[model samples]
Target: MPPVTERTSSLELPCQDGCVNVSIVVPIFNEEGNVGEFVECVFAALTPTSRAFELIVVDDGSRDASGEMLLRLAAERPWLRPVRLVRNYGQSSALQAGFDRVRGRYVVTLDGDMQNDPFDIPAMLDRLDSDAGIDVISGWREHRQDKALSRRLPSYIANALISRVTGVQLNDYGCALKAYRREVIDRIRLYGELHRFIPSLARDVGARIAEMPVRHHARTHGVSKYGIDRTFRVVLDLMLIVFFMRYRQRPLHAFGGLGLWLAALGVAILSWLGLLKLLGEHIAGRPLLTVGVLLLVVGVQLVVAGLVGELLSRIYHEGRGGAQYHVRDTRN
Candidate 1:
């Protein structure tokens, strides 16, 4: 066959119709047994598409044969891009690596375990096709196949809390399958659990978001990884995301909001006490007075905290980096 022409831009290929460009990003942790079938299924799903596409598989230091399988597939298929991490970095890092490597105008991310249906890829693409302005098409799993306690319950609670906090009403946040427009992919910064918040982050940066119900299949290989501990982690991340989304741009706003509430209540209490004293009211040991003083002091402290947060943010942008979650271990 002809020598494969290589493209260098971030979006190396755009679809012929200029409709919806596509990239299939698969993050493989340790699913050694499923690699072959997964690739075959992905290619099969894309076989009839008229649009241009590429498959990027990130090997997160898989201790099993996943790395070798990806390497072998990469040699056979020009569209197959294989990335290897230095160690077991986890799924978020793997997905980010794929995102960094994808050159298609629209990037679609799916798990390597073969749980998320590649057949649904075109559904998301179709949604994007109908409306080009949409920045991301999130896959909503209406029929989840994982265990009720392990996956469904935790996911429901987390998704609900995240939606309420981020103000992005996508029904599913933890669904590993989603499609991102090239511009949307370019603008958002990816980190730790922020991958789950991509839709919200994109919206924060003025990108349109949409969601669709996608086909969810039961896992074909390996054991499920969800647990109660991870559930707590999800909640914790949600709270942090709430703070980041609401106050990241204006640290003063977040801290100051609380401060203002406290200060107002404190002032009201003191004002009432002062009016009582002026009227010859012997209200010396009123609990409101003590509470008011305490609230005032705390309010001042909160304002100071905002100032510190602002300075820290400035310093972060100046040279030093911002907060990063360091991974101590992963199961790949």
Candidate 2:
């Protein structure tokens, strides 16, 4: 090993052969008022760990004073690191940028709006130490402090549907507080609002997921970024996730099942006509013929649609140019 050289002028330095234990990744979007308070509480929460940590605040193209606040904090505090994006891509993209730049044994993600309690982070870190099999420890806000109808109601419905469809059995899938091991960063990818479905993605790759109740504080400095129209997107994404999770490797299964249903209807209609012929009845200008023809046509179309779906899935996922990861910012 080389001699440890300490820079007298600088208190903090980049990763020098694994000196840090945890990295906190916060995605900021127009929350300029709360950045200083958030970082202060985060550092106080992690101070008891006896391990060096870095607080990385990713600015997702805020037109407000968020970027300026981050720069100020980075200058005053040695442990504070700020990365800025060119424009506001979204929360998920900002988080992806944070995860890609993590240099710690474990990483924790939290929203910068100060809704998620930083005090609960230590409890999550303790859980990670106990269970070696656990890949991710998600924070479940059993007693959500948000507005009951507008925010809580939709989140409840979406969480129920997500549990039923994905079979992940997580209480609060949309909670912004969660801790992940370093290995999970390579396997799962996030786009759009898909960050809420991280538990499902981990389960797809055979990772054990568990949840514990955490404190939820109502929004203080900024407005709620999500709106009511997100309900439709959640439903649509649920169905797409079900299909991709179940039949990602085999395209024929998804399409073949639909084809069989259509073919069955066509056969049933034809059987009714055959019975009529056997009983010596006229089969001219019958409605059954039209029904059978339509079913057959639809059946063929569905099969063809399935085949097309498979070809596209393979081509896009396998192509080198096609990608899912997005960039918000990075540090040298």
Top candidate, metric lDDT: 2
What TM-score would every model get versus the actual structure? Answer: 0.78, 0.82
lDDT of 2 by residue, 1-332 (tens): 11223223333444343777788899999998889788777866776566678888999999999999899878867778898999998887888888887887888998888888887888898888888878799899888888757787789888999999899998898998999877776677788767778889877876788898988888889888876777788999887788878887666678867887997899888888889989998876898888887887788787887788878777887874554443433999
Evaluated at residue 3, the lDDT of candidate 2 is 21
lDDT of 1 by residue, 2-21 (tens): 12223233233333334435
Candidate 2: stretches off by over 4 Å: 1-14, 76-78, 267-287, 309-332
User: Which residue pairs show collisions in model 1?
Assistant: none
User: Which pairs clash in the backbone of model 2?
Assistant: none
Model 1: how far is 188 from its true place, Å? 1.0
lDDT of all predictions, in order shown? 0.77, 0.81
